[model samples]
Target: MKRPTLSKKIDQLIYRNHKSATTNVIGCLVLHAIRSEIFERFQRAYVGMANKESSELGNLPTSPMAERARTCETTGERLRNRELAYGFDLDYKNDPPTLVPCTWSKNYAIGLYGRIGLQCYNLQNGTNLKFKRLEKHSTKRTGRYSSVYITLDATDPATGSVCSFQTQFSNAGSHLRLRARITWLTFAARIKQIPNEPIDDDWDEDTPGINEFYKVPLPKWFSDERGSKKYYVPESELHDNDWLQLLMEVAFFSKANRRLDAYLPLELNSVVVETLEDEPRDKLKADNAIFYISYKCCADPCSTPLAGDHRAVVRKTMDGKPGHMCLEVAFTKEQNKNEEE
Candidate 1:
């Protein structure tokens, strides 16, 4: 056998003299991912990779590796136990998109979509499940369609008992159309060991609603979610960072779509807004929601501002999800100069 030198092109790798050359490959890769285009290609290759990350709590795969992991400790868990080691949740490349719960509770827009999914499922299955509240949700984004997986508890009228559910949907173009859809949905099973209407336990808490629903809802509109609620908000709320950005974007694209020419919104004018709520006509209730913003945006950044009222149809919700939601300019309505002034 040839002598194995510590490193290539070197006589020896003196372990003591040089602290072992740490490859630090992961760190390097992370840096490269941020700096290089190759990382984007890598991300594209694994765009839907989380579809295979099914080792979530209740949805754990029956694979041998997963089976063994269930009985004992996982390598990650072992690493976590060691004080010397540390873990970064969803910080690394290829990690499952982080799940959002602590935040979704306050996000009214997300709650709107969750209701739409439940409403659609009810329409198709001939079941009336009243929405209680959102528990959590996650999402995977792509250029054209961003996939959403949502979890929440609901009230089953037939049983008059509370039940929990998970649903998956996409925000493509199914805005306020009953032709809207959810990819899959599931509810908590009544296991004897689980007591009291089978509410959320550790197993239920960790269970994901990505690819499994008890039954398909709205086979026709099953690819997306659509529906929206409308109410007046204090003008101050419109200036919130996320809301302002979204409204501006909606303003920019709305003008561009009709004109087919490049245009941008320079300023947002505060005004009491009239909101529109559209209901889908076909299979299920609308889950893709649209928001009506009666606000003005400057067409020419350097010129005098013109007043305009626009409605934004925001379809998607962020991932974790509060990450990304779709928004659209429904229509640009003209405001009388007298009123605008």
Candidate 2:
């Protein structure tokens, strides 16, 4: 007779583990505690890293030596960011100031900052519009979808002005248009700082050195017979073991213990209103303004309108719900009808 397979064995273990009501509750609680403890540690580590990265360099006097040193250090010190404008220090005052080709740059990592909102006004038309939140239907288990959306809105009298808000170039070069200026904050993932360099030469064969890294004590909930395998624990409730393992491995090999890093996409902070100008698009005669407002994430699929399993689609529906949102597959019977026709 063949022995039981690994999957079957795991299933048996799970069933056995949850067989008793008391044991199941105890196991979940223990697992939850372990996860929470580990997450606190990870967060502390990340905070440490972030604090280290945001450190200000020693004040060096302005001189040729300093300039030359900066140039030399830039190769490693400065981040190789493609969407440099996505940082806190950007100047969008000048129209279309050197945008990063409207693409997501991998040099930066997107993280949870908070919700963002937008508003615009057209002085010429005496109208204004407000944006509604259109966030992804996220759950603790799914982590969080990096992208967020706002439903385009306007005052009742200003309704007609927002009709073409979704279309590109619909508001370009319009008379006395006012738009808000906002900054985007993203973290440079590739950039790492070693606050203190390790002395590799000092470690001898007899010395434990970096090789003697301490392992985090995992709770008894980790055992195969201790917890349910079918249910997934959310990151907020428990630190993801895989992520923790990766961090541990990196710290061990790089000798960067206690070093933490995080992406603080607080770059989108500036909120200013600016007047518009009539450009070539508007000069073309009869049509909507040649220039429309556009918002870019600058952290996703590196192309126009960051691509993902969920795409940002602006649709006018008669549902009569203001800023109502949902996820569904895009399909229509028109395709079949067209084929038959």
- TM-scores, all candidates, are 0.30, 0.17
Q: Candidate 2 lDDT, tens digit per residue, 181-291?
A: 111211111111233111111112233321211111112122245322212223342232222222222212111111224321111111111112232232211111111
lDDT of 1 at 233: 49
Model 2 segments beyond 4 Å from truth? 1-27, 46-50, 53-341
The most accurate candidate by TM-score is 1
Candidate 1, residue 249: Cα displacement in angstroms equals 21
Model 2 TM-score on a 0 to 1 scale: 0.17
Off by over 4 Å in 1: 1-104, 173-341
When summed lDDT is taken over every stretch of 10 residues in candidate 1, the lowest stretch is 83-92
Whole-model Cα lDDT per candidate?
0.40, 0.25
Task: Report residue 286 deviation for candidate 2 (angstroms).
Answer: 4.7
